[model samples]
Target chain A: MTLYERLGGEPAFQAAVDDFYRRMLTDERVSRFFDNVDMDGQIAKQKAFLTYVTGGPAAYTGKDMRKAHEHLWSKGLGDEHVDVVIEHLGATLIDLGAKAEDVAEVAELAESVRKDVLGR
Target chain B: MNPDRTARPAEPSSAIHLKGRTIPLAAGESVLEGLERAGIEAPSGCRAGTCCKCMLQGEDPPAMSQRSLRPTLRAQGFFLACQAYPIGTLELSSGEAPEPIDTVIQSVEAVAPDVARILLRPEDSFAFRPGQYLDVLHPSGALRSYSIASLPSDQVLELHVRRIANGLVSSWIHEQNEGQRVQIRGPFGQCFHVADDEQKRLLLVGAGTGLAPLLGIARDALEQGHKGSIKLVHGGLQPDRLYMRPQLSELAETWPNLEVEHCVLREATEQEHEGPLDQVAIRLAGSLENTRAFLCGDAEIVRLLQRSLFLAGISSAEMFADPFSPASP
Candidate 1:
């Protein structure tokens, strides 16, 4: 089974997505990127990102990731911002009762997209 | 296990009706796949139901397709195309305006400095929830939306319209007479109260004329005998902007479970609390657990309230909103 299914699929991801988004919105380190954004639309994007990192079926491509973050580059998005997201992904999974090994795997998967997300 | 052969008749195969074309669904094929097979470009993402990007409205769609959406969206016939497996032919919602209904103005009274309470009686039978909004079609073809402030049992449609400085539709509505005829359509929106849990506390916050839908919802809940506490906080630029104080005060007196509070940004009267709306509302809400919030008024302030309340502990699913944006010329 894919890690997505092993970790409880859609319902489990629903719970994790809200927690993950709350953390990002509340965290001063990365909250600036979300100003003037619609809450529902941002939540949907977060859910898609969570699905991609957890090895679920996602329509996102590396090119899409680069384009999505392209505008944020001028606002000082870089490796540090990517690291903050990765850290939050791991923390969210751990809080949701994910095994340590699974959280590590998810973090590794998230890191693989760092270059694309930061337009490196 | 014995297979039942004579207990039930064979059901009809499922098909999709879209834009005057009928497309049959192959066995095990989803509605999205069927649309794609028929050379139609349907918006979709993450073909698995998690993304919720392929939502479409349908008549009597499968319950399973709407499971992940909120109750209000589901009630509006929205379903995820990727998850739908309709057991019967389903008619899709084309992006066309519904037919307008003719109504006669029953009354029009100025409730505040710029707000008018206009009542209308539809010539034909009309069905709508109290908090849902409808479009008023101006004689010049401009359309504007207003939320229903009166329950259906009142036998008339009530709207609280705040006249914008140079708004065409609002100006026309404010100048209408009691016997005048008007055209309206819709009853759109998903901001009404659902009677799912009688014991769930309701926190309704509105600014300026946003009190229309909240008043409808509060009345609907109380009429349904909601046992949980309901707190309504109405805010404005100043105390003069807050209308219907006497009516709301009498309502609070009638229902022990309902408590009404008025707030303003400045010039606090003895009866009004003064501060930023979001801060005042969060402080008055006290405990946020098990609370469902209905936020209304301008888009920016509604967004602020939504984020603040969500952060204060209300679940995203428990919050409904109607954020009005200015009608573009």
Candidate 2:
């Protein structure tokens, strides 16, 4: 089975996405980035993005990362903000009982888009 | 024709003097891009400045954007080619050439089931910094890079070779006998002990044989009389894989400021804990306010730690890393 299947597919992905945002929105270092964002809409878009990227049936129809995060840079988004998000994502995956190797794989996938997200 | 008269005016372009070659740079082009345009293959990774692979020393220092450079390096005018944009004429040095050295294997012993520690005696002129790596050329012409695990004071080269299944160079290294001759080219990489401030705490973390360079660095730091505390965290897949446990423990006993922690991924034994190496290291050493971290290990672990440590208040410039990727045979 693929890592997505072992992670319990849609249900697990949903749980992880929800928990990840919950932790990220409360992180003082990164919460400010989401002050003006619509939490509900952002969460939905994130769910689809994670689902597609992790090999689920869903396809992400949102904007590309560079376009999606272009405005955030003006708000002082930087490498530290990206690091905080990745930490929360890893914590969420481990909290949801994913295997160590599986968590590492997912983290790497998230890290691959860092440059585009940072618009570097 | 008049001696002062020129047939045509010189085109306006930024000039870069590198290794006796002058290359023209267009507007908004990075040094690396300009070099590549001139058919120069500069070592680089992630072009975003997260990786320091494209480092070069030069005069007329360009403004640095990345925080990966050490303060000492910045003062010395070392900059990353991928990030440095030259505004005027610049003089940069090319990457150093690797010198080939012939050495005789003094001993090869199994430190773990799949890990062998090979000691070599090189020619009298051979020298290398702790945490640097060397490329080993096998009899079959296959080459592999391994970090130098011995300090400069040792006057000998040491390598920790992980026996990859069916790997050409690794298998050859494991089967080699004492007094066997081998060809190596090296002493590359910049992730060594700098001794910038002897009072700054040292946090050295590695996984598996990644501990090789870290061991050398820790020893170098102590030899240099660094007054701050030094912590070495070595993690592996299992307890038995923490190969230098006895040696590191002995060093810790004699060095009052040095502490060694052994960790395992799962099934923690009484002596070792079950956790990731980065997390375990952070938990043991609270508050990295003034710490200089030297990281070498699995690429994924190194990346994870780089992000985590940067978020935990450690400046990116203070952390030096050598991420290891498996070489294909």
In model 2, the runs with Cα more than 4 Å from the true position are: A1-120, B1-55, B58-68, B71-96
Model 1 scores a C-alpha lDDT of 0.89
Question: Which parts of model 1 are misplaced by more than 4 Å?
Answer: B1-11, B17-24
TM-score of each: 0.91, 0.61
- DockQ of the two-chain complex in candidate 2: 0.04
| Lowest-sum lDDT 10-residue window in model 1 chain B | B1-10
Most accurate candidate by DockQ? 1
* Candidate 2 TM-score on chain B: 0.76
lDDT of 2 at B238: 85
Candidate maximizing TM-score: 1
Q: Report the lDDT tens digits of candidate 2 across residue range A27-93.
A: 8898777664543346656765565555554433324678888999998888888888777777777
